[model samples]
Target: MTETFVHPRAEYIDTRQPPPPPQPPPPGLAPPTSPPYITSGTEECESRWEAGAAMTEWEEKEVEEEEEEEEEEEEENS
Candidate 1:
């Protein structure tokens, strides 16, 4: 019995590619824009955070008072 072996085409397996030269994009193309309004994913994330929770005018006043008291105590100790 004789065995006949056939080889595959070379083009199908060839992996050599020239390193693509760096090129800038054409200037006329506009950048993609995101949706103007909040989406469902954004809404869920926002709900998880305290809505607009930040140091308000009253909270700032309390912090200022505490700091001043500490400064006065330091002066008295010296």
Candidate 2:
């Protein structure tokens, strides 16, 4: 007995198509006209930098206070 096998065509196996273009947002739910970062000026940037520096200073003071408390506790125990 002899058997014959037929291969499937490429079009039948792979029928992939290009993805559709992105759709615009609805009129009622459109994105903001101007982003916050784009509107921010040098003054805002400077204030943010100053705030970050102040936070670091505050953290250092907290660590120093904690160290002082630990030292006092050690002295009391000794």
Candidate 3:
């Protein structure tokens, strides 16, 4: 004949109940409307490059104008 024994302090968990739902954020805080950052596309890169080139041309023109004005002032003072 064989004999079986069980532990007296073992506990059993109930699996019938569902887990609790997630909590919502407090007042005055809202979710983001858009992503934190964006990955530039080919069109966007081209546009940015064109803008930079235009700005460089504008700055060169401004420098030339300032140099011409300085030369005029020097001629007037001579």
Candidate 4:
């Protein structure tokens, strides 16, 4: 008659206790949300006058497509 088996013991972590003091935001949590674009000054002078009237209507449609490609190269060189 011979039976012997017991091995389970390892837990004494007390690392000089001092790391637990930051946990207080769980009571219907709600306290941090406010900053969604809030610019002023007449909305920055109407977004710089609508970006200078969209860059002066894109430089007047590139000077009316370079004056209709110089009047279609002067009517295909007459």
Q: How many residue pairs clash in model 3?
A: 0
Off by over 4 Å in 4: 1-57, 64-68, 75-77
Model 3: lDDT equals 0.64
> Candidate 4 residues 2-64, lDDT tens each?
876544444555679788998877889785453456554345444556777443565557657
lDDT of all predictions, in order shown? Answer: 0.65, 0.67, 0.64, 0.65
Q: Which pairs clash inside model 3? A: none
- lDDT of model 3 at residue 51? 73
Which 10 residues in a row give candidate 4 its minimum summed lDDT?
38-47
Q: Quote each prediction's TM-score.
A: 0.32, 0.31, 0.31, 0.18
Better of 1 and 3 by lDDT: 1
Q: In each prediction, how many residue pairs overlap at the backbone (N, C-alpha, C within less than 3 A)?
A: 0, 0, 0, 0
Which residues of candidate 3, in runs, are more than 4 Å off? 1-55
Worst 10 residues of 3 by lDDT: 38-47
- For model 2, how does the per-residue alpha-carbon lDDT over 1-78 read when each residue is reduced to its tens digit? 888665666336556787999788888986656556746444554555677744456655765787999999999999
Better candidate by lDDT, 2 or 4 = 2
